[model samples]
Target: MADAEMVRRETSFWRHAVVTVPAILLLGLASGWVSNSGYGNPWFDGLAKPQAMPPGWTFGAVWTTLYILLGVALAFILQAPNSGTRRTALILFGSQMMLNFLWSPVFFGMHQPRLALAIIVVMLVLSIATTFWVARIRKAAAWLMVPYMVWLSFASILNYEIIRLNPAS
Candidate 1:
C-alpha cells in the first residue's frame, strides 16, 4: 500500500476525531451564522416559493448536516500528505465554500434570486470539480462530498424554480 494510504489507515480514531470534530464544529458555526443572518426575514417570506419548496425548518437541518460532512471531508484532505493534488483540491474546496456562504446573502438578504441562481450554478460546477480533485487524492474524502454535490444540484433546481415562480424578482 502507498505511504499515504498506510498513514490514513493507521490513524487512531481518537486522534483523528479530535481534529475533525473541532474543524467540523467551526464549519457548522460559520454556516449557521450565515444562514441565520440571511434567513427568515419579511422579504423572503413575501416571495413566491416553488411548489416543491421545503419547509423553512428543513433548510437549517439540511445545511447543518452538510456542513458537518464538509468538515470531515476537509479533514481528510488536510491530513493527507502535501502534494499538488492536495493544493488544487483545497483551492476548489475553498472556492465552493465561499460561494456557498455567499448564496444566502445574495438570495435572501439582497432579494435577488436570479443572481443567486447564477452563483449556485457556478458553485455546483466548482463543487463537482472539487469532488473530482478530492477523489484523486482520497476516495473516502470524495465520498464525503457526495451529499454536498447532491444538495447543490437540488439547490440549483430550487433556485431555477424560484426564478420561474417569481419573474418580477
Candidate 2:
C-alpha cells in the first residue's frame, strides 16, 4: 500500500511538471516570435554589430535552450504551495520576461540599440532579484536561472557594444 501511494504521488508530480514546463516554454516562444517579427533581413543586417555578436542561428539555438531551462525553473516553482514569497517571485519572473521580450524589437526592429541596452540592464537587475527570491522557495529553481543570468550578462555587453558601434542606429 505504501509503495502504491508513493507511485501515485510521483505520477502526480510528473504530471504537474509536464503541464507547467510546456506552458512556460510556450510563453517564451510566443514572446520571442512577437519580438522578432518584422525585424529580420535588412533591418538586422543594417546594424553595425559588435564583433562578438553571435550569428543569427546562434541566437535561435541559445534562446531555445534558455527557454527550456526557464520552463524547468518555473515548473519547480509551481510545484511549491502558494505563499507571499512565491507570489513576489512569480511577479518578478513575469516582469523580467516582459523585459526580455521587448529587447529584440527595440534593438532589431526599431533600431534603437541604446534603449535596448538600458532595457537589458533593467532586465539583469530584475532577473537577479527573481533568482534570489526563487532560491528562497526552491534552491534548484534558483540554480536553474544562473545560466540565464550569465547569458543576459553577455547579451548586455553585446547590446552596449552595438550601441557604441551604431550610434546613429
Candidate 3:
C-alpha cells in the first residue's frame, strides 16, 4: 500500500510538471519575442521617452520575471481540478496574454503608443478579472498574479506617459 501511494504521488508530480514547465516556457518565449521584436527599432529609438523610463535593459529583465510569475500562476490554475470557473479563468488569462503579446507590436513595431495604451487598458482589466477567477480556485495562484497585476498597472501608466511625452510618436 505504501509503495502504491508513493508511485501515485510521483506520477501526479510529474503530471503537473508536464503541464507547468511548458506553460512557463511558452510565456517566456512570448516575452522574448516581444522584446526582441520591439527593442532598438528606429521608430522606438526616435520616440521621446519619459524621465521615469528605466534603462533599456530593465524592460527585458522586468518582463521576463513577470512572465515567469504569470506562468506559475497559470500552471496552478490549470492544474487545479476541473471546474467551470477554471475554463473561464483560462479564457480570461489567455485573452490578456494575447493582448500582452500584441502591445509591443502596436507600440514599438507600429509606433502607436496611443493604441498600445488602449490595448494595455483592456489587458489590465482582463488581468484583474483573471486574478479574481484564479483566486476563487487557488489562492496561491492568485497571489502569484499580484506582481503581474502591479506590473501591468505600472506598464499602463508608462504607456500613457509615453503617449503624452511623445505626442508626435
Worst 10 residues of 2 by lDDT: 32-41
- lDDT of the structure predicted as candidate 3: 0.79
lDDT of 2: 0.81
Clashing pairs in 2: none
RMSD of 1: 3.1
After the best TM-score superposition of candidate 1, give how far the Cα of residue 160 lies from its true spot, in angstroms. Answer: 1.2
The lDDT of each candidate is 0.81, 0.81, 0.79
Compared with the true structure, what per-residue lDDT tens digits does model 3 show for residues 1-169? 9999878755664576577657766765665466554457777777677788778788778777777777767767766668899999999999998888788777776777888899999999999999999999889879988888898898888888878888777
Ranking by TM-score: 2, 3, 1
List the candidate numbers ranked by lDDT, top first. Answer: 2, 1, 3
The model with the greatest lDDT is: 2
lDDT of 1 at 165: 80
Q: On residues 65-159, what C-alpha lDDT tens digit does candidate 1 reach at each position? A: 88778877887787777899999999999999888878877887677889999999999999999999999988988998999899899989988
Pick the winner on TM-score between candidates 1 and 2. 2
TM-score against truth, every candidate: 0.84, 0.86, 0.84
lDDT of 2 by residue, 62-147 (tens): 88788878877877676667899989999998899889878877876676778889999999999999999999988988998999
Instruction: Evaluate model 1: give its TM-score.
Output: 0.84
